[model samples]
Target: MATSGPVLLVSQAQQRKSRTYTPSPWGDFFLHHVPCTPSQLLSMKERAKVKEQQVRQIIHETIASSDLLHVFEKFRDESGAIVSGDDASCLLMLHDAAHARTHGEEILDGIVAWSKSRLQSLVVQKNLLEPELAEEVRCALETPRFRRVKRVEARRYIPVYEKKSTRDETILEFAKLDYNISQAIYCDELKELTIMVELHFWMLGVIHDPYCSRIMIVKIFVFISLFDDLMDNYSTTEESNVFTAAMERWDEQMAQQLPAGLKALLVRIFNATNKIEEELKLQGNMHAELIKKMVINSAKFYHAEVKWRDEHFVPTSLEEHLQKSIPTSACMQMANLALVSLGNVTTREDVEWVFTFPKIIRGACIVGRIANDIVSHEREQASSDHVASTVQTCMKQYNVTIKEANEKLRAVIEEAWMDIVQDSLEQERPRALLDIAINVARVADFMYKREDAYTLSFVIKDIIASMYIYSV
Candidate 1:
């Protein structure tokens, strides 16, 4: 039921009043936009594809050569061959070679076993390896690249690629530039987002990896954040009702009575929706109607919250708050937006599964909503104007102290994650789609684990620096 497209900003008076809110230390740097044109996006995509092909070719050639196999064979015959267990470079080669789809018959099964045994011996002996190589060995042992998060794998391999003397300098340079460009685009979108809604783009880029995918994530969250602020702080009961009706109607003619800011926001949302629809159409998807329905449903939920606040009413029980919170959280809408970048890989059936509110998706929404409330409840209560957060509702319903309520909510968050993992195993859906749901919860944990990191940027400065300023 959550909405999509660009979000509308709060009234100018409300914005001025909220200026007392703490701003990020990196505000100045983040605000300076570095525009990335369509051509640049296309070029980066092409470069990434070409680099991937080159890496594949290099792996294929290394596997075909018998030099590494001969070394392994020599060690296999000796009682104590002194094979360097810290040879991650060699281990990586073996891992990829064993998994190669099309390869000349060189018999890699024995080599894989021999290499794995030595690696295990190194682990048993607690042998010291360079930190980078040590982590690589641990990851290879624990989770193969195929099952690992793509961004983590990319970050880990970039350093390995740089260490090789035969590595193509030009490709490495291009990769570095591509990364910087991506960071810049993220910053530009984030700056515009922060003007109305306090949020971060770090986790989105990490999970999505691709440039276009990251952009879509930023767009979706930006709108969600702004809409949340409007419902929570800016709109009155009458204004909220009028706005909701206009959104449900979804026509320019219905927007005439809206305030200036709401009018502008509606126009922006429609523009963004149109743009997304065109892109999806080009990709042979018919998602415009579904997205429109989602936006309208989200507005209806927003109106419900406004009515509750206006009537000075609190939910009678915790379950009541959850029923409303699930749709209002907007996690499902965000998940669908992320999937748009996946193109034909996501089938119509996959989209239907998302809409059905399966356990994995429901668990993610619960985590996102409760985690945010756990950290931000006191701050929201201080305002005395916001709708009842889950933390407060639980305290009132159970007649417990704030500390006790938070402890129970924390337990609920943990249980939700367990449900997500269990459901992921049982479901037959695409792993990529499931990962999107998991990543939403992960991002929520990152944003609110210590405090309301999304609202106060200082808490997440180090994370932002590592993701943007420093390269792997």
Candidate 2:
């Protein structure tokens, strides 16, 4: 449907009415609530590391003598044996066992199968349980803690743990402190990101990690976000074309060709890329050149979307759209950032493996692209001169209604998730990169669950507060 000339005869800036985003609900609230100073946080981290080593050594000694099969049986007995008497503990065990069975580690598969069977029985008899316990049972059966990542489960479980008669004060206090500290770190990251007009975005994925290295990654996330905003929403086609060429060359002199706004944008882009390169190098990452290459490649992908918009191009089909869309989803770049952000533990092999854009990462990128497009299609089109969204391309290729196209795309999202789960269970890659890929996918599902939560920040105001603003 596009041509050499833009289909929209109107000036893009004239037609591109900006969306008014609200100030974050917890503005400046976190800056006031940081319980510990920077030095204290560092001390706490060091102490936590020491304690973790002690715990790991103890676990190693225990595992050497203990049979995991026998340990799993204890779960079977605890949950299955007294299901009528202890609703909460029994429900939790059955839930754990059921999900564990579905993922089904070979050694524990038998016990997990038994737990699913037992859990089904409890579900059938939920009528006799306390109302609250029945709800808990339903949630466990449906969403299950195993399906949730650590942070999500932690938020859900902390309250549940506190309700127990035997809840330990030390553990409870520790959980409170840990969550708040993580929240504080998130606030600090957000403050830096705000300078770039971003985040509460990246921290959705990096919520658990508080190291300074992650701030650099967050910077990249912000820069890319602003870069997209500039090209897709604000800049003229000619300006975007010029700026993209400058980026491709990565030459400072090219900035002279841009208008004032784009000139500053190009300078910031170079400065940010250089800083990331510098930081990665300082950590002894030998793959700095590759990282820079990825940054440029990602920018090129972003510009492809802009060019599509500029030409008013609808992709010939979904396949053509995805060729660029998947990479532009930011999954690959974030996965690369995740590798280096973890510090010196990243081996050359790890960097090489991630750079390959392995199967799991592709699946994750699919989910990130499609899931986001499904939720964000309207907002993006309205706020910017958006090219054909995933939905549009699907509709055009399949000749389907918007609802039907969305349904097909939603199926694609599930397929992508299946790929992620299957690949993760294989354990063929570095655990950290795989986990980060999964988290990137998780963030997509969450941030776009019912709305474009990132742009429509109010949708997740309570969530942001819970994760970063409020105490446990």
For residue 220, what is the lDDT in candidate 1? 51
What is the Å distance of residue 194 in model 2 from its true position? 4.8
Candidate 2 worst ten-residue window by lDDT: 76-85
lDDT tens string, model 2, 265-378?
789878878987887788776766666676677678788887687677889788788887887787777777777677656676877676667777888788778978899887
Clashing pairs in 2: none
Each prediction's TM-score versus the true structure = 0.65, 0.77
Strongest candidate by TM-score: 2
What is the TM-score of candidate 1? 0.65
Any idea what lDDT model 1 has?
A: 0.66
Q: Candidates' lDDT values, in order?
A: 0.66, 0.68
In model 1, the runs with Cα more than 4 Å from the true position are: 1-206
The clash count for each model shown is 0, 0
Sum up the clashes in candidate 2: 0
- Itemize residue pairs with steric clashes in candidate 1: none
